[model samples]
Target chain A: MKLSELPFNTQAKIISVDKKIISRVAAMGVIPGTEVKIIRASPLGDPLELEIKNYNLSLRKQECKLIEVEKI
Target chain B: MSKNLALIGNPNVGKTAVFNELTGQTGHVANWPGVTVEKKTGKMDKEFDVIDLPGVYSLSPSAIDEMIARNFIVKDKPDLIVDILDATNLERNLYLAFLLKELEVPIIYVLNLMDVAKKRNIEVDVDKLAELLGAPVIPTVAIKGEGIDAVKTKIRKIFSDGKLAQKSSIPVKYSKEIEDKIQRTEELLKKDAPHFLSDKRRWAAIKLLEEDKEVIKEISASPNGIVVIENVKRFASGSEEFDLAGERYNIISEIIGQTYKRDKDMITTSDILDKIFLHKYFGIPIFFMIMWSMFEFTFRVSAPLGTLIELGLGALGDLITIAWPEDAWYTSLVLDGIIGGFGAVIGFVPLIFTMFLVLSFLEDSGYLSRAAFNMDRLMYKLGLHGRSFVSLILGFGCNIPAVMSCRAIESEEDRLTTILVNQNISCGARLPVYVLLGGFILGDGATGTIIFSLYFLGIVIAILMALFFKKVIFKGETAPFILELGDYRMPTVKYTGIHMWERGREFIKKAGLIIFTVVVLMWVLQSIGVDPDTGLLAWGTDPENSLLAGIGHLFQPLFAPLRWSWIAAVGIVFGFLAKEVVVAAFGLILAGEEEPEGLGKLVVGNLAVAGVAAAAMPALVYGYLVFVLLYTPCVAHLGAVYKETGSKKWTLVSATYGIAIGYILALIINLIGGVYF
Candidate 1:
């Protein structure tokens, strides 16, 4: 499933990232095998904040959709 | 021998605080990323030269800050890399450390925010971590000045003993397959090793395999480089970069597993705060309320202080006028040109400082990021994401830094749009003009409302222009909003005070140089002209025949639709130099006719003389304020825009757009107001 489709607080392991921003997303420590939890979505819900490796990162739902993930 | 120590870290890891603590240099440390966009250098204990680099998550350069940090580390080749890590988030930060380790620089690992980490029951075994990383690991609460001496001692030891490099651990190992490919690539690179100047061939080979653009460009320029690149590319199946990153994380996890421990159930204070601060319903309103209170605080607190400054300048002007002979050219020049023109701009120092004080507080407290996050929805409509708003908010303080801060925006189109629209935000320099005109036209009771409305109008217009430009001029995809919301911390009075003073100092410097020169030139133009009747040179005699009047007449027609007179036209022209000069030009123009009690009175009297009727005064002033609000930013901001855009064509486009928008908006406001009021 796409990372953005995960419900709030759901923990998932990243499977793959889209080619366009794979390096950028990975550089922020969101590589494959990393367990990420949906922290909070913006009030409008277009952007979602996630917790990975004890740090919070907010990314647009569009960008989030590019990351493939599986529920852990 | 003194060594250059480069401080590197992930954003918001307190790298700058560590730099400040080590070097005793105030480098605008904030809770946000990209505050230190440029590298700052200072001497540490007269032994090491400390360079504070912009924080980056990894050496792979995707953003401007990351590019700067990567370029500096590779090109500058500092002797020692002081890698500052946030102890609370070692797993994420250690990835960068691993990357830096590949650069082969002697590393001093400084784990900052130990206090915060401990609060959440995150304990790091400093000695074990040091042994694993093969570097001196010092735990510090940078804000509280803990472990600073230990860091200094380590630096001193490195300089004296030169033992750090030998003691450093081997770089993180990749998986077997990746390791085989890297060894092969490194061996291939060894044949052309002379081109690799930094002796970081392993790093270069890995980057080449990872297809790092800068490294590829470097290698591709050399002989037989394409063959090597092709070979490296063939070794990895399509996912080598991800595999490499995953391998690094695996190593980091091992190190973290051995040396780090934390309470699983301890919720951070930031998480608690975010519940209310980032509340879906209340976030934006709370942001605006805070902003409103900030402006209210600025205007209310500065009013009395502004009055005091005005009184002092008035006394100084009187003293200058009395000390010189009556009717003398020097007397007029000193009192009218120097005191009148310069004092008008300087009178708002109190307001500027107050506004900056509050802004610095917001910036340092990390609330500014949350505010940007709240505005993401609105900003998204304008082809900009949330981070663009940070630059716009900085625009309120000054457009120069705001334009410079556009470097932080990842998208080229969004950044340029931000730079172009930033000038409309009613900068602090433009505040005095608003307060002066708004107070004159709408009375004290409505001054705040008028000011707020003008600011709101500026934002609205900026949004419209951004949408138009995005669709028509520079069409592209908006970069996704990816920002780290930093933890909210109590702002220190000392830091805010220093920030306020730094910005206020820039304003004063402009007054001393740009304002002073422009005022003198204005005085010269007003004082010298051919006598229209006799055709004789009339120096400071016939005011109607002055050069300024001639220039004003030429420009007055353009602004005539808004009902602005020739003098106001001249003021607007001078305003291009700096916005405050509009008020100053008016003061200088009416200097001899009357010593108006205040700037508001002088502006009011001038409007009446300009043939603006009493009923239309408010409307005309609002229209004129709109023009000033949208017009081309001051010369300093234009220079910044040019520098930021790196294209004169875009600069001209921005300037022309601003003037056209200003004229059209002013005309619209005037025509609508004429029909109603």
Candidate 2:
């Protein structure tokens, strides 16, 4: 499932990140094989703030759609 | 004898943890040089003084943090420079190591984060790498204190040798044509500039080849500048190396291919994320929502704390009045000037703290760089270099740091432009203005809308200013920014909390210094008079009657054109001293009213007056806000301008230009509104 489609605060393991999101992911140090734990999602479940590798990052729903992930 | 050493690397390479392992004492962390980047210095287990410079990618200073690191290395010239290379990202880390080596300083390489590398199934042979570079390379897990003692013992032995080991030439690989150009430029440079980092000079030439503005300016300003520019330009233009960024990337790619082995898959992570976030249709809204929430949190989460701070100041003022019942001057000084003025400033502490906390989270978690990347196109549209986006973001914290952050832009023109536009960023200090005015002029719920509008105003004004400055002041080609978007990391809560509190404590400390002095000065000005018996002091209740009031009156005609009442006019005048003081003065004037409840009541009532279905109120308020927004930034910000620009002329230009633009805009708003209303 797309990461953005998940309910708020849902934990997910990123399965595949699309090629186009490289710059954004690179900026955030998010590489394809990293586990992402969602901490909070904006009311709409679009800009999700996630906990990863000892840090928290917020990404928009549309942005999250690029990442292929599965709920844990 | 153990010699002094400093570990310098870009932030996040475990410099602090390494310092802790080496020193055994929790290192004392402060800002590097004058910049806000954190600096850690301590004794190496009671053997040597080890300074941990803020994490910086390269020695060519750009940001406050980078400048601090660069200046310390250049000015302090530590005995040995330990360049900590992140094992996972050796190529980029080595870019800085290459620069350090060029400084003619002996740099020992420590490949940190080996555990993380191992987890990733990446392997690096430390001995082979050391042999290749002619520097001892030690692999260690900085977090676990692994191999740190060995690294320190090697440093001691190297110091005992009394002569540093020479590293073989690690000439960064560029294209063959570019390499030829560098060799030519090196020959020309060798004749005159012996003291410079010859390799750094080569890099600077290439940056200039890429038409880097800041480097160009530095060269142009020097006596040898014209010659260097002509020589480099000849080589740059001849080879069509204007695509310097692409060329540099290619070189890095080639070098990585040869020396480093990575799971070729790592690059794909960032690309995938960038696609959606950098997508034209969706990226902007996502960015806007993030900003909206940031402001929302800044206001909402802080409301309770704001009340607490306000009440604390109120109680303190009440205590002073009760304690000094006999001393009216001192009582007024404490209550009206000190408490009142200071309270107006301190009231925004909650928002400041929360904002910093969020900002630190964004920065440490690596979202800020993404935001910067997403904003790059817009920044270009606004006629600003993308690097300025980072500084502008920093401006949300404080104009001083923001102004200082401008150094990150490699172009002098961009740096100056960023500094000028920085004031329009509306720092936390000025948040009180938005909170006060938005609350006072708009209404309770509308306060958010008002603050949002004011922020929008700042952005619009910044865009306009950029356009104007580009056309008039610093006219040249708009330098295209090529930014490296770092990967995302889960932000460390402990680090983010520390960063947030550190900034909050700074705001409190600034109140203790800058606001304290100004508050006392306000009291002194209020107290002085010619005669007590006549009750007609130097300046009457009318602003024209007193010293500051008299000066304010001199500018009344200028503001009169804006439709401000004399008291309102005077408030804007005192705003130059500090924007927050505008509220304090406004509070004092309304307190002069019959049954006035001071600032709080004045804000609530006046905002209602403005919100009522009256065209005149909106017009007048809009005009008033324009003046407030464009006028000279506070004295502290001006001091910051002076420090950042390092010129009295530019500071004057910034102050005068802001006031001039503000006056004209305010005049237009009021005049048009007057006719329509």
Candidate 3:
């Protein structure tokens, strides 16, 4: 499911990363089992502020869809 | 000679903190060897020398910084190479390590931020990994002084071993067909060129197949050039060859998997902290507030010190005026020209240092990476790299280091874009101009508002300038920015203070060296005149008489369109030479009481007396400030542009474009206002 489709403040677990997200999501140390949290979403649902581990990482709308997530 | 060991790594990887721990002396910040790659090198415990090169990803050798790091490792050949790696992101870092191993130098990997790694439940056996690569690996938390001694001892052992070239036997994983193709390419390269290329030909061939420009450039320059490249590219399909190139990653991933296992963790400290900083409602406002506070603190907190320095310089000028009363020419030279020029600049040390202090704190705490992520959208629209904001922020302190920070940019076009527009950001030297103009227009109470507006104008101009330059000189789509948003960590006060002091010292040194000489020259020009009795008449006294007066009158027509008096014209021209020179020129030529106490009042009085309306002062002041903020950079910054871009054409283009835009903008303001007022 698209990350923007998730409800705000919902915690999600990343299941698999596809090749489309290689540029943005790949360098960020995002892999299977990495816990992700949606802290805030922009009004347009483009850049979503996320909490991954100890840091807040922002990903563009297109980059967010590459990570297939399972609701915890 | 103490054997120097430069600790090279990407920025925010705890390099400086590690340098401080190793050296035990305050580290000094300066340009890297040959270029303005902001480097920090110090004597380590009085025996070993540790130089910190600016952060870079690959030694592909496209930019000045990459060249500097590549040259240093290849030429200077430090006794031992300590490649510090962020443990959290080993994949990307290990890519560089593989390249470093090929340098044939003894390299010891320092896995920093191991504490952060432990939090993620990712575990690695350092010894096993070290054995696999034939290099020593030591886990360290540089901020906490952990494992430094062990790293240091290992470094000594590396020196003793005389840098025994460790032939890396770690094979890359490629398909059988690709491996056979690479073997053929390697044999051909070995036969064609044995001593010309440093890296293995197989690797070079692979890179060529991947369309790496740097590798292609080397091959084209070689004996069998075009044919060899055509053969390599023709052998492997583009996508297949590219996968083969990434074979290094496949091998590394399997190796890491063998030594490490990953698990799920509930929460990371970075996540908990981001809850507040990245809050949707509060994020943008909080960022603005923090920025506002930084500017406020820089000026207000440093005001007392700035005032004290101004007074001290004034007193010194007075003493010099009194000391050589008979040598009027020499005395005026010392008092009006030299001291006046430097005094005007020295007063800004506090603001300069404070800006550096704030940036250092943000950078050391790893908050700057987050800032890049936040400002990316705004910067992208401006035709610049997102990391350019970091350079622009650094420009607040000084333009020299700011230009150097352009190394973080990966694309040539974006790098040039950042360098060209960087000076639009108000530098410390321009602070006095801001303070004086802001005070003149808005009074002391509104000084903060005026100053803030000038700074904002700088940002706006930078964005516009980037758009203009890209459309004209550089025409291309900027390579999309891909950056790792590092987690925020608590900044170490010790390093922050030390870093701030280092920047402060550079400003003070520049003031002493450049300002002192300019002041002396100004004094000599005015003092040694035919009629020694009356002293040099301040410019515009007789219009036809006095060197400065004649020059100011000649330039008067040009500035008339900007609604400036001959005196203000002189001030603006001097400003182009050096922004602080504007204040000194006004103080010397226009503020006529031999020595004026309040510079802002002096400036106001001169303009008011010259038929420049009191109300027009604000418009004129804002207009003039805008011109300076967006105008041609001083000689030092231009020199930096030349060094960073390594092109005289770009340097000339940047300077000419800035001045043309500044002059046109200043003229537009006056033309509209003259008809109205």
lDDT (C-alpha) at residue B279 in model 3:
57
Query: 1 or 2: which has the higher lDDT?
Result: 1
lDDT of 3 by residue, B346-448 (tens): 6776777888888788777766665666676677667676688888888887888889888777778888999888988888888887787677766778888
Model 2 vs. true fold: TM: 0.71
iRMSD (Å), candidate 2: 10.6
**Docking quality level of the chain pair in candidate 2:** incorrect
| Number of the top-ranking candidate, with lDDT as the measure | 1
Fnat value of model 3: 0.08
Clashing pairs in 3: A54-B269, A54-B270, A54-B271, A55-B270, B333-B523, B337-B519, B338-B519, B338-B520
Per-model chain A TM: 0.93, 0.77, 0.80
Using lDDT as the yardstick, the better of models 2 and 3 is: 3
Off by over 4 Å in 2: A1-72, B1-4, B10-77, B98-104, B140-261, B266-276, B319-328, B501-506, B530-557, B587-600, B603-615, B646-649, B672-677
TM-score of chain B, candidates 1 onward in order: 0.94, 0.77, 0.86
Interface RMSD of each: 1.3, 10.6, 5.0
